[model samples]
Target chain A: MKKAFLSTGLLLITILILPLFISPFLVYLSTEILVFAIFAMSLGLIMGFGGMPSLGHCALFGLGAYTVAILSEYTANIYLLLGAAILISLCFSIVTGYIAIRNKGVFFLMITLAFTQVLFLITSRMKFWGGNDGYSASVTANFGFGEITSNMGLFYMMGFFFVLSYFLLKLFVNAPAGKVLKGMMENEGRMIALGYNPKTYKMIAYLIAGSMAGLAGGLYIYKTQFVSPALFSVHMGAEVMIMVFIGGLGTVFGPALGAGAFVFLQNYISTMTDRWPLILGLLFIAIVLLKRGGILHLIQFVTTFGLKLFKPSRSRNAPVDKQVKGKEQAS
Target chain B: MIELKEVHSYYGHSHILHGVNLKVNKGQCVALLGRNGAGKTTTIHSIAGLVVPKEGAIAFKDKELIGKTPNHISKAGVGLVPQGRRVFSSLTVKENLLIAERKSTSSEKQWTIEEIYQLFPILKEREENMGNELSGGQQQMLAIGRALLLNPDFLLMDEPSEGLAPVIIEQIKNIILDVKKTGLSMLIVEQNIDLACCVADEVIILNKGEVVWQGLPNELLHNEELLKVHLGV
Candidate 1:
């Protein structure tokens, strides 16, 4: 517990001071990472905890982006835009989740993919929303404080939301409802026997994930000052899935770390070579083969290995060792 | 407190249960005895709403349960301890128990975490151990403890002694008796006649998706002809 606190504190301090040492472009990239991190984390909740795999999570993200874009044209009231983004995403998820959640396994995946495709088609064809060219309208609202005209101000705003989202999501997964969702994932029959409607819990998870994704989408538009039909594309959805897989599915902070790594790699590699995706694909394959539990598991393995190497006697006196000893004595 | 009237369940063109009827009165233990493929598990599944019946009515405390979902059935005060001890393999023993914990609506005493620890001391000892880390007997105890945490008026146990050793089966028998003393109605499906007779107030023998015999435990013990023909004991 102490170690977790220390690491969290260290991470926060590092992120806070990142812009001070880095270039303006890197700050912008950092904001992008945070946005995608929230997106990946939302997907992770449903896929990892609720055992409901969705291929159209980008629909929620896109919906939020479009809501913010359209709303910003009339009024730049940040709160209104954010609220509308979340509300729109919630409505979309409820409608889509009601239909998609009924199907299990591959069917669920297919249904979600179909829904996203439908949204993409609508967004691209609708001329009122700028059609295929998308919308790049400037905002007037000052996120409740003042005009966030500067990149640093925008970075701080993104950081604030990132921290808030992280804590909220962490609280959610550790709550009683979250535990039931995990139980549902493990054994839906058992959860039903225990008086938990799996569908209700699943729908709740879907809503939470959708809202979080919506928040990310709102932030995405604020950071880029644009909204495009590409936001709802299948490729973007696949990218978030890859990020979740690279981070670790169930671990709360894994997706954030995954998004950071993915954004950094994508940015760095794209600058050097057009074959960056080939390298990214190889890296994903390696991670999957070597560390099935993702980067978090890999980090854990390394840390434990380092600890054992540094303090062999401490490892011998570990609680697990004591348990084995107690069992041997009993037998 | 639970009754099934001519419950006819099907599994995609195959009629698994053919008008099966059973009952467990308040504070009573009724054992459904049958050989493999005799629809014993199907009967329990039907009660739990995992296998919805095609026809006939199931009522728990006079409320129709046929059209209700499994979770709704559970909330209506019916708990199921499924076959294979389907405890959450990824969760710890404590987590498994806590997730299933629900307050009893009736005036009956609630089953607290401490009480469960008292009943299964091993679980308390391995509170942090993952479900998959436990032994078969331990998993069965966890499964029973999980169901008890729901604080249900009726419990359905399917093959509690299917894969356990004789010693563990004996322990399970005592546990069932203790649970019965708590005034919870139970419908236990079992192939082991000894375990069935040990805790049951009545015995039901099923063959080919139909109840062929129903009698007192002592009556079943004395009727060797009935036992040999139906159970092949």
Candidate 2:
């Protein structure tokens, strides 16, 4: 627990100090990474913890963005936009989750994918929302603070949301409902026999994940200043899944690390090489083939290796050793 | 009390249970004995609502339970210790027990975590261990402890002694007897005739999904020829 707190503190301190040393473009990139990290974390909640693999997760994210885009036209209230985003995304998840969760495994994936595709088609064809070109978000909502027209201000706002969503998700995942989710994932039949309606728990997970995704979507629109039908694309959904897998599926902070790596690769690697996707695919294959636990496993391996090297006599520290071992097994 | 009349169930195109009739009165322990593939597990599944019967009237305390979902049936006071001791493999022993813990609405005393630990002291010792880390006997004990935590009025246990050492089986037999003394009704499916006869107030034999014989446990013990023909013991 001490180690977790220390690491989180160190990470926040680093992120908090980062923009000062970096360029304006890097700050913008950091904001984008933070937003995507939130998105990835949302997907991890369901796919990793709830054991419900969704292919159309982007539907919620897209709906949230569209909500922000459409609402900004009428009002500049950030609270209203965020509220509408969450409400719309939650409602969409309830309908989609009902249909998607009825089917398990690959069928569930397909149903979710189908839902997003339908949404994508609608968004692309609807000229009121600017069709494929999409709509620009011209809102001046201050989020109860000063105007956030500056890049640094927006970056800080994104950072604030990232921290807020991360802690809230962590709390939810450690709650009794989270334990139920883990049990349901391990054995749905056993959960049923134990008098827990598996569907209800699954739906709850979907709603939480969807709402988080909606929040991310709202942030994404603010960062980009635009909302396009492309946000609801199947390719975008697949990319988020890749981000989750690349970071680590079940680990809370893994997805954030994954989003950072993914966005970094997309932004920097693509600039340096034309075959950046090929490089990304190779890296993904390597992770899947060697470390199924994703980047979290790599980080854990390095930390443990460093600890062992520094303290050969640490066997006497049984509690710390056991805690590390427990984390190792969980990943 | 629980009763199943003319329960016919199917697994896809294959018929698994055919007109199976059984009853367990309040405070009674009824053991369902049959050879492998005699549909003993199927009958237990039907009662637990894991397998809904195509044709039957299953009543638990006069309330029809044939079409209810497994969770609904469980909430209605039926606890199931499933075949192969299917405890959640990833969760800790304490978590496994606590996950199934529900408040008992009955006037009877509730089963607390402390009470469970007392009932299975070995479980208390290994409460922090993951479910899959335990030995088969320990897993069986944990599975039973988990079911007991639900504070059910009735329990449907499938093949509790299927895989265990003789010493462990003896321990299980004693545990079943202790549970029976608490006045909770049970329908246990067992291949071990000795264990079945030891704790069961009555025994029912199944042959190809149909109840071929129902009698006292001593009657089953005495009918060696009947056992040889049906159970091939």
Candidate 3:
């Protein structure tokens, strides 16, 4: 546990120093990655832990973006705009989640997608909200300390929220309630027998995930100063889902690593070719076919393998030690 | 302290339980014996609120439980050791126990993790192991322990000795007896007649969802004609 904290601290320090040496464009890219990392992690909370695999996660994200964009015209208070965004998205999740949670498996997925499509149509065709051209908020976010107009400032703010979201989710996942959620995922029947309302837990997870996704959306608008129908698009929803899978399905930090890897690869590849999505699709298929529990599991495997190599004699004696331990316990 | 009167449950359109009625007195262990598709499990499910009965009254300590959700039934001091063990494969042995842990409402003894560990020492030894890693008998023990942690006044156990060796069944029989000693009333559904007769204070036989016979365990063992007709023993 101490080792985990130390490593996390080191990683944070590295990220903190990275922008100092990198270009402004890279800082902008990093900000985008952090925002999506928050987005993907929110999706991960429900999909991985709550066993609610949603395809309309970007609905909350888009709603958050749109809330901030529209609310900024009336008020420059960052908290109020962002708070409104989170609140609106939470309300959206409650309504949709109430209906969607009644169905399981494919039905749940289809219902969430159907709701996202509803939001997509409203945003895309409304001329009052800029229609297909999308709404661009020209106002700067005031933090009381100063206005954040630069990419570097936005990157640091996102970095802070990214770390906060990771720890918040980690705390939740390790708690007794988190264990119940996982148990519910494995055997809903058993969980019911054990006195846990499966729907209640699933709804709680969905609400939190939606709010977090909205927060990510609120953060996202700062990076682009733009809100488009594309934010609520099915394509964006699919992309976040792909990020969650490619990074790791069940791990807390896996989604962030996934978001980072996805954003970097997409940006790099799209500059070279128009068919970047095809390549991304192929990569996703390859990862799923490999079935190695995503990049996080692969990394874990490598590190453990390296450790085993360093202590070859200990590895050989491990089974013998286990047997002896078993005998001792039996006695 | 648990009573079901004319409880009729169904799966979609096909009815599985037809007007079932039974009662378990306070601090008594009643064994429900029957053949396959005899609605033994459905009876247990009905009480646990897993299979909400379409008709009839189920009262636990005089409180109606027919319309309540499974969790609501569970929280109302009704614990269930469902058929197939139903242990969460993803969680560890300790996690399975901890998830269901609750304080007893009454002045009766509250079952704790330490007490459960004492009851099943093998569970204590394998605390770090996942639920799926345990043997069949160990899983059964874990299932019983998990339900006990709910601190329930009444327990509904389904097929406690469904898939086990003779020795393991004997062990499970003793475990059920020990639980019975705690003054927790239990209505156990069992296929193994011997195990049922060994543990139960009273025996009830169900055939086609109706109570075909109800008597003492000894009387059940003595009545070969009744057993051959209803249970095919």
Candidate 4:
């Protein structure tokens, strides 16, 4: 636990010092990555812990963004806009999750996808929501304190929220409730036998994941000042899922690292070629084929390898010996 | 404390349990013995609410449990050590125990982790081990420990000796007896006649989803005709 804390602290310090050395464009990109990190981490909650692989997670994301954009026209209260967005997205998840969670595996995936597609059509086709063109928030981003005109200022604000969200999610994952979700994922039948309603826990996870995603969406619109049907696109939904997998399926902060890698790759590759999606696809194939688990597992392997090189070889075999002894004793 | 009256259950079109009636009075242990496909598991599942009965009433402390979900049934103080010791494979032994820990009422004796460790010292030794990493006997002990942590008033054990060696089966039999000493009513389903007769207060035999004979363990063991005709022993 202390090691995790130290590493997280080190990473945060790096993020703090990063903008000073980077260009303004990179600062903005970092802010975007932070926002998507929040989004991906939220999806990770359900996918990794609850083991409910959702295809339409972006529905909640889009709902959050749309809620903020539409609400911005009425009031400039950033708190109200973000809060309403979160609450609305949470409600949307409750409705969708209630129906979607009834089905398992492929059926669940299809239902979520269908729900998002319906929402995408409605937002894009309707005149009130700006149709395909989309709606825009105010250019000057102000959050009660003052206008965040500089890229650094926005990056700092996003970075703060990113850290906050990460800690909040970490707390939830460590809580007894989260442990139950992990158990459910491992064996729903066993969890049921243990006196836990699987659907109830799934819905709880869905609510938290949806609201957090909504918060990311709210932050997203503040950064881009634009909300469009593109936010709810099938591509967006699938991309976030990919982000979760690329980071690490079940780790708390892996999704954030994944988001950074994904956003960075997308931005970097797009600059060189128009067919960036094809390149990205190939890159993903390579990662899946070679890495097997995700970027997080690869990093873990590297770190352990580094440690093994430094430490005596005898210590490495200790756990294995213990496990073998345990087996013998058990038998 | 638990009663099942004329419980008929089905699996799709094929009916499994045919109006099975059984009861486990307070502090009593009933062993359900049957051949394979005789609906022994179906009976256990029906009581645990894993298999919802089509037409009949299952009452725990006189409350209807037929329409209740498995979780609801479990929460109502009925615990299940399911068939094949369905321990959560990804979870550690400690986690499996902790997940099922429910606070007992003031009237009931609370079963703690310490007590569980005392009961199964090997579990304490393998506390950090994952469920899948354990041997069959260890897994069975974990399964029992998990149910005990629920502080359940009644337990439904389905084939606790399903895939264990003779020595392990002997250990499981002793564990069952130990648990029975706690005054928790149990309905144990087993094909192992010796284990069943050893621990159970009364032995009930099922044939084709129907209760064929119900008597003392010694009586059943003594009756060669009933054993040969129904159990193929």
Candidate 5:
């Protein structure tokens, strides 16, 4: 309990302090990272604990955004739009997860990818959804149920959702069903042999993960006041996966850091080169080769080095366990 | 308590079991003995619904099992301790037991975490350790403990003594006999002929997907030439 308090306190400090030092552009970028962070965390719940490698998270995200877009087009009430988005997105995710989770591993991945790819193609060509041009939501204070058109409000909402997501997911992973899902990941055959069905656990995980992604997506579209097919692209799915991998998955908030680092690098480097993708690809190769764990890992490595240099003799009195505290090689 | 009649199963194009038949009365300890390539595992898999039979009927207390999925079959009260003792490696011993839980049907339930701990006290000691960290004997204990938590009436244990030390195997054999006192029926698939002969209420020998012999353990002992001729060990 003490550890949890300290972690939350540290998170609160970062949330309060980071915006003060950074420019509004960086604030906006980090807000974008917050949305991605929520998405990646949702994906990690299934991939890391539920053992379902879902590549169709963006489908759920896009569905949420499009649901809000279509509803807001018809009705201007912000409360109704938010409610409608949640419901519609949840329904869509449950249906998609049902189809996607029936098969085994790689097949599960392909099925999810296939479903999202189809959605992306339809969004690109469909005129009703604004096609590739995309739909811009109304953002007036009075025009749409006291909608906060200001960027700060949007950032606050994103951050709130990020914190909410982390806690909700933490609650879930500790639940009875969550334990079963983790057990399924460890050994499904044994689970079956022990008189427990693994399929139900998988399906539940898939649906919950889908709903989480949907909530994040809805928040995202509201923040941007825009909806696009790009939200459903394969790239979005890959980006979420990269966040999970880099976040040192299984630890809460790791994916958020991963998303922050990825977005930060992209923002700073794209200013210098038009071919940022190629450079990013090479960097990915280097990360895998270096086995750096992730950007947070790199940060840890450097921080330790700097701390050691600053007080070379201080460690003589300090505890050894404190140095590498909480740093573990995830299985 | 269990019956399989005219059970035929095929793996892809290759036919495995051909018109296999077996039965276990309540509290009966039946052992399915065979050579390495014989259909003992497949027969167990068929009864457990891990493999759908091409043609047959699997009835546990007169309810059909062949058409059901593995989960539904398990829910119907067939607890299988499968080959390889496939314990959930990432889960702790406590968690592995927790996942196979069934709501208590009786006001006085026979099995609880306490009850299972009594059955395999070694599991109680390693409750915090991950399943993979345990030795083979401990894992086998965990596997049995996990199944016992469900409190099923029948257990289908595959290869309980497949690769354990002799002493551990002796302990497991005692555990099996102790469990049988609860009136739980079993269809155990074992390669250990000595252990099988000692406790099995009846022995059924399968030679290549066909049941060639069925009798009491004493009768099986009397027919040692038949066992030597067929089992090859």
Candidate 6:
């Protein structure tokens, strides 16, 4: 109950207050942060819950971006643009998930990485895929509902997607099959012994995660109006891992928080100095050492401590004394 | 009935089983008695399609089962409770059973959720507890209940009593007998010779991955010298 209250309060504050005060540059950055948060959360659903760490999620993300970029270039219809991207991503996710799920742990990770790298090379070399120069993305015509080509309007769309994606992820983890995936992570042998074939369930999770990453990519193309080969880079995979860890591995809200903090750090540092990667490297280590779990745990600690200091045991004086007296009598 | 003939197996190049043969007739409780690393578990795995047999044939009711997947073998009415009680640790007792609830192949005798809970009453009480929350004995019972829910004609149990309390072991033996009364044949791998001799009708002794002796439980019990030679009991 307390958690729900806190989260809702934070949500209201972020929705109403932050955009009012923060500069447009920071808002733009926040928008990027939220998009990446969706991406990170999707990957974490597989890594943290399903115990399948993927190094090829960028492939799915890039696929989504390219799909949108390609379709939007040819077609002005918004629904068609989104439809093509989603369908393409879903197909890629299914195929990638099938081959990857056949292996366990490190092998699964390696095979996924191989698939992504192959995809990267394909995108870099193919002529129709725009080769290494990449493709120019175009915005949809709003289906004759006037041009929705404004930055603020696009921000709201991205924010809505972020919220939708987050809730969908929560629903999945709470479902019966999702619980089985968690069980598989804890003890796969036992799940098999129970006669619940985990392979099928895990494959479904991988596909879902991949498709979400793709959806995020599709939104990313809409926001930026460009799609590039670097979207599938190895560095993007590492950034995703960092995002999940920074947010707090399994918490629902952690991914968004991590994305906000991380993207802000990158933007702020890049403006101040060219040593942003160096700064990120140091912060990553400190977070691992200090928070252990992630920034989410640190935030939780601070919230509780701040509450305790402000209240200062004022409500418990009479009840506490009575409890002490009662204990004394019992003794 | 199930038969494994001249089966050989290896674990990453180390030969584990060499020329091992065993059979269990329908409605019989057969036990494989061996010390650690005696290929008893390996033999069960081979039959369950978990491990591939290099030079042998496994026939279940005279049907070839060598090249099939684990699910196919399971579908063929061969249920295995593996060496460790590998109950899904995050699932509740009820969820564990529900997850693997396959309808009985025969149209007339489907194993329902209530029937599984009836076989193990403790499961009904702890239906909502996570798999790891159960006691060692409870986990063992859950494992057996899980396999039985598949309604297999034959059950292969590997070390179901290991690490369990004696009282729990007795419960397991009783459950085995109760299952036996229902005409489900079992291949039991056990180091507990006393429990094996009690629950099993026939005992097959494996030594160094080779079958050294096979006889009635009474005859095997009477011959202590042979038991010591093969089983190191």
* RMSD to truth, every model: 3.1, 4.6, 3.1, 3.5, 5.6, 4.9
- Candidate 4's residue-wise lDDT over A1-331, tens digit each? 4544665677679789999899989998999999999999999999999888888999999999888888888887878888998999999999999998888888888899999999999999988778999987774567778988888998998898888788788877766788899998888887997889989989999999999999999888888989889887889989998888888888888888889999999999999999988987887788788886689998999999999788866535569878788779989
In candidate 3 the C-alpha lDDT for residue B101 amounts to: 93
Query: If you superpose only chain B onto the true chain B, what TM-score does each candidate give?
Result: 0.98, 0.98, 0.98, 0.98, 0.96, 0.96
* Candidate maximizing DockQ: 3
When only the first chain is scored, the TM-scores of the models are 0.91, 0.91, 0.91, 0.91, 0.83, 0.89
DockQ of all candidates, in order? 0.79, 0.79, 0.88, 0.79, 0.50, 0.28
- Per-residue alpha-carbon lDDT of model 2 for B1-233, expressed as tens digits? 88999999999989999999999999999999989899999999999999989998999999999989999999999999988998888788988887888898961657888998888999999998999999999999999988988999999899899889999999999999998898989999999999999999999999899999999999988888998998887
Instruction: Give the per-residue lDDT of model 1 (tens digit) for A172-263.
Output: 77778888898888878778778887888899999999999998998888888888889889898888888988998877788887888899
Over A62-136, each residue of candidate 2 has an lDDT whose tens digit, in order, gives 999999989888888899899999999999999999888888899999999999999999999999879999888
Docking quality class, candidate 3? high
Q: Judge candidate 6 at residue A273 and give its lDDT.
A: 96
Q: Please state the Cα-based DockQ of model 5 relative to the true two-chain complex.
A: 0.50
Q: Is candidate 1 or candidate 4 better by TM-score?
A: 1
Top TM-score prediction, candidate number: 1
Which ten residues in a row are the worst by lDDT in model 6 chain A?
A1-10
Question: What lDDT tens digits, residue by residue, belong to model 3 across residues A1-331?
Answer: 3544665677678779989898888898999999999999999999888888889999999999999999989998999988998999999999999999888888888899999999999999989889889999965777799998788888888898888888778777777888899998888887887788888888988998999999999988888889999987889989998899998998888888889889999999999999998898888898889854787887888899999778758435679878788779989
Candidate 3, B153-208: lDDT as tens digits: 99889998988989999999999989888888889999999989998999999998
**Per-residue lDDT of model 6, residues B9-28, tens digit only:** 88889899998888899888
TM-scores, all models, native as reference = 0.92, 0.91, 0.92, 0.91, 0.85, 0.83
Q: Considering summed lDDT, which 10 consecutive residues are worst modelled in model 5 chain A? A: A322-331
lDDT (0 to 1) per candidate: 0.88, 0.89, 0.89, 0.89, 0.80, 0.82
Fnat per model, in the order given? 0.85, 0.82, 1.00, 0.80, 0.72, 0.33
Return the TM-score for candidate 6, rounded to 2 decimals.
0.83
Per DockQ, what order, best first? Answer: 3, 4, 1, 2, 5, 6
